[model samples]
Target chain A: MGTENLVRKLPNDIGGDEAGKIERVEHELLPWEKRCHALADVLDFHKIINTEEKRRGVESLGAEMIGKLSYYERWIVAFANILFQKGILTPGELAVKMSEVEGRFSDVPDTRQS
Target chain B: MSEQHDHDHDHDHDHDHAPITVDEKPGYFDLMETAVRELLIERKLFGADEIRRQIEVLDSRTPALGAKVVARAWTDADFKSRLLENGRTGCEELGITFYDDTQLIVLENTPAVHNLIVCTLCSCYPRPVLGLPPDWYKLKPYRARAVYEPRAVLEEFGTSIPDDVEIRVSDSTAIIRYLVLPMRPVGTEHLNEAQLADLVTRDAMIGVIQVGYDREAA
Candidate 1:
């Protein structure tokens, strides 16, 4: 495996390797995450949270530009959708994102053992 | 971190076919969940369906529909005052319930101090209004840290409470739950009830995000 350009991302407590692992998984699952855009166009979380055309304007940006938002923004967009779609954010909801792979950039392998 | 969990029902912890980028499999929430579930069932503590049934029961309350209540309150000061006094009842009027399992705590968001609510123990929440808890909110760190240092946590979310505004962290334990009733946004006296509801997000109400600021109008 090439070690030159492995962009690492993770929680505060986890180390670089750990963060990198999660980031790799998240990236693999969604290299170009656009559930937020779908939420804006279909589910509509952007307007609900920010209450505006620009702030919640994930629609106009298109998947091309949305693919460019920071990982945090992408997560936030999903977060907004959670608040919108469901009246409350529920436990184990994160699994939904990991599973949703329609038109995604990376294909993360679901290694969750049951 | 090992506990007991017996899963008599069909459980799904299948994250198998992800990608090469996900090298180390940082964490497996299901592993812990299974252990805990097995322990409970083995101990005759609870069946999987009982726990699921409990959530189903809690979700039956009226306050679970939060935004509708907030929108109504934002537009009606009288109702807002009622909400401050009794969040559950106020929610009831708007067809919201705190659910049957948990006691609901309503933390009003004032001008001086913004109230941010998080669950430190488990994912204890005002399910009636808020409905379900977020994935990250159930984690150990978010549960523990958010209460101790609300400001630091908010900073991570890209929100920093001003020095002038005091930050209040409310942690809902097993029985008690809290909700942040956001301060009414300024220059919106003329807006209708529908317009105001558009602005009151669950994030602002929970304090992860703050209301917008308008300097020019000020």
Candidate 2:
């Protein structure tokens, strides 16, 4: 494809592109990943954001971030941005809460709350 | 060379970096997940327990659910037709609840034709029945190759389809997900539905591999 087409093409549109061998690796979902998924469900269930909105949210992240981040990583990041766009949560609020949460995990590397 | 080696290992030389490093700090995304979730709860958009319940619902789903439907179709001809006609209704008959509104299309494999599913745009999958897709399914290569050269992709999973067999690749979208109903292996006529269900692996349902019957010695 030409540069013009590539520029217009969405990042997730990778069908029929030449690619390497498939790595058949099965990863157990970490606790945070499951929680991220659940957050998606909760967000959709309550109409804060629907599934299509979330899909578009991830797509809006562009190709570079999509390729670099893990699946749920893209989602969590997208969710934050989408929330920001919707004015549901501000960046300042999220940053403050993240620091507050981070401080709670003293001496423990796992920062997720039980 | 020694100077270069020292520069590379300078940060790590202070600590014993073994084969497994357990004390690694969390990444930015990890913090974002906690922050986003906590903010959602504190804002009363949803309660924390609601998220917990949703996780429980997701955990309750697995490939066993898909296998049960496949085994039933193998034994009951009526169910097979129904599943082919409308997958969501067919699965609902088996008491499986679909949380989403996306349609489920069950593709059947025969001697002359094979079916494979891929989500090129994103990781759209039949999560209600088969749970989350395998890691390979969500990756770029499988999504890119499966639509064009499905036979080659299947071969990577150790499933070789003869040239005579037409490979029908289904590209899933956000609105439609697919499940493959693989052919039952021969010499398993004696096996019960439960026994047959046990043989239907996730890979088989994904159409990457055939359900192999390795009969334990009686």
The lDDT for every candidate, in the order shown, is 0.50, 0.84
DockQ of each: 0.03, 0.45
Give the CA lDDT, 0 to 100, for residue B75 in model 1: 76
Candidate 1, residue B104: lDDT: 62
- Residue-level lDDT of model 1, residues B8-98, one tens digit each, is 3222432222232332232232222232233323444334445444435433533225666776877788998888887778877875543
Worst 10 residues of 2 chain B by lDDT: B1-10
Stretches of model 1 off by over 4 angstroms after superposition? A1-114, B1-64, B213-218
The docking quality of candidate 2, as DockQ, is 0.45
Instruction: Output the chain A TM-score of model 2.
Output: 0.87
Candidate 1 local lDDT, residue B18: 22
> Candidate 1: which docking quality band?
incorrect
Candidate 1, residue B115: lDDT: 87
Per residue, candidate 1 scores C-alpha lDDT tens digits across A1-114 of 554433331121211121110010112223222222222222221233332332334333344444465433533444434343545433444344433321132232334344
